[model samples]
Target: MNATVIIPAYDPEENLQRIVDRVWDLGNHVIVVDDGSDISKSDIFHRLSEKAIVIHHEKNEGKGAAIKTALKYIKENLWDCNVIGVMDADGQHLPEDMEKLVMKANNRENAMILGVRSIGEDMPLKSRLGNAITRFVFHSLSGVKVSDTQTGLRAFSYKLIDKLLQVEGTRYEYETNVLFYCAKTEVPIIEVPIKTIYHDKENSCSHFHAIRDSYRIYRDILKFSLSSFSSFILDYVLFCILTVLFPAGGVGILFANILARMISGGYNYFMNCRFVFQTGTKTQTALQYLTLAICILVMNSIFLQIYAGIFQIPVYMAKVLTEISLFVISFFVQKKIIFRHKVSGRGMIKE
Candidate 1:
């Protein structure tokens, strides 16, 4: 595959050497990022650096940062490399599995190839539950079906490095964002089954901070879900109030719905800007958001007018039905267009 393998290490155990050796034996250049491992671990990195390129960090950065560090290195020195790959230093990812990803990427240069893991009964409880939950939520929100959302063994055309670098997250969350971004951008994904290995029974080698990192990974979507639900509540309540006061059902539905949507949309926009998307760009955001809200409002009005006005459905029932139908569309627009995350870098990139 003419690939460069990037291994991100943070206080890694002896298995790091074994993995590097295996990768090197496979005839691929290896780059290891010593993500601020302990001083005692320097000897291992030093010895491995003789064969594989080793980059050291002054202090501990998250796994995502380590990967990015390696990616930056690849971008500058190994731009001619055909493929770029990432594997875990924790020893869970096998070199052969990595090769599978690289080969698949070689076949499909336009797609990102993932070495998906099989979550079996033998896997640790936390690992199993974590993968299952993350995989489900990721699919539900992004509409991308991935078997293992957290698999570190992945490969793609060297061209993808820049796109990945532009993504947010310097921790576990970064990988999740990568999946989300690809799904949003319509990037093709090819998954290949890979062998799952756990050196320890408890999977204790993983440095993932269960609570802190989980929150980091799911924060954006979590906040967005909360903001959406709350906005819906406010919208529903306002519609009820307006209906009671003005006594509108058919044609009156348009007036009542628009008034309620405007108010709720304002609140939703405020929350998304300040908290949910955390978008930093000031250009055209107001105009973009206004356009999306208008679209949603129009859709909502039509649904209500048709359901409650023509069919004589109850106003509240029609309102609920209409809002539910528009929910996914509104969320998609806000996420993909109105409040998309700003890329950290500019220009063409991939990995």
Candidate 2:
């Protein structure tokens, strides 16, 4: 199989040359993206250019942008290559592991192959904890159980290149975005076990910003749910206000529930469209959201009545329980049905 390996480098250490040399020896075309490294580091890329196609960024673009640039280059120039692989310029990814991913891609023409590392006891504390959290969050959001959600060593067929390029995020979050996109689009993923090599500590030469990048990554995947939570809070507060204004009987509770939902549901729809999902035509999304709101409204009213009216629980506490019960259901429905078109595959989604 014809394959091209893309290495996105930003101020990489001297070990980059060795990585590039080994990758070249693996008998695949190589592209090294110099993500605006400093002048002193220019010699590293200059030397690499002799052995591989070196692309330069005038200034530092993030890793995602650099990879996108390389993908664009491949699309425009080396379109004949059937497989595309991405690996970090840092020495973490072994050329053999990358080869394993490539071979896996050759077999599964429509699947993304990841080089998953075992997080052993010897792993750094932060890395182990971070990967565990990210893995859990990724599965929660995407319903895809990936052993390594942050692995840079990945390979996919050429058909997926355009789809990946369209994925949002321009930093470390971009890698996580790819997984979300694949899961939403029903794209298959295959994991290949590989050796875990951490030079010094995991963060020794790594450019990953734990707090900032973690927020970005989680924000991208959880924005919809977070927005829904905000709307839920508004909905609950409105419910409480309406309950206070009206009587404490079922009639009063019914009115308060409907009116409060009308207000908060509208806000939720607006926020989800403008900030969360951020795609699909306004009319179509509104229609779908309207349906979802009605369903949740019914469910919410039933739960509130059971908790507050029949069970005689406090109205405010009942409201919280009702909203919490429907939170996961609402998010999944809206994401899978309402916003499916946003990240739906080009021709991959089955009608």
Name the weakest run of 10 consecutive residues (lDDT summed) in model 2.
342-351
Q: TM-score for every candidate vs. truth? A: 0.75, 0.86
- List lDDT for all candidates, in order: 0.83, 0.85
Candidate 2 residues lying further than 4 Å off, grouped into runs, are 248-250, 281-291, 306-313, 341-351
lDDT of 1 at 138: 78
Residue-level lDDT tens digits of model 2 in 213-323: 899888845787788788888878888889899997889989999999999999988887788877734787789889988988899999998998789998789888888
Model 2 CA lDDT for position 296: 89
Model 1 lowest lDDT segment of ten: 342-351
Q: What is the lDDT of residue 190 in candidate 1?
A: 72
**Pairs clashing in candidate 1?**
159-350, 160-350, 160-351, 161-350, 161-351, 162-349, 162-350, 163-349
lDDT of 1 at 31: 96
Candidate 1, residues 1-351, lDDT tens digits: the string is: 578999989999887889999999988999999999999998999889977999999998888999999999988888678888899998888899998788777777767777877778778889888898898777656656778888888888887888999989998998888887777666676778888888676889899899999999888678988998999999999988887777554556567778999999989988988888777546598889898889888888888888876888887888888888987888777775676643322212222
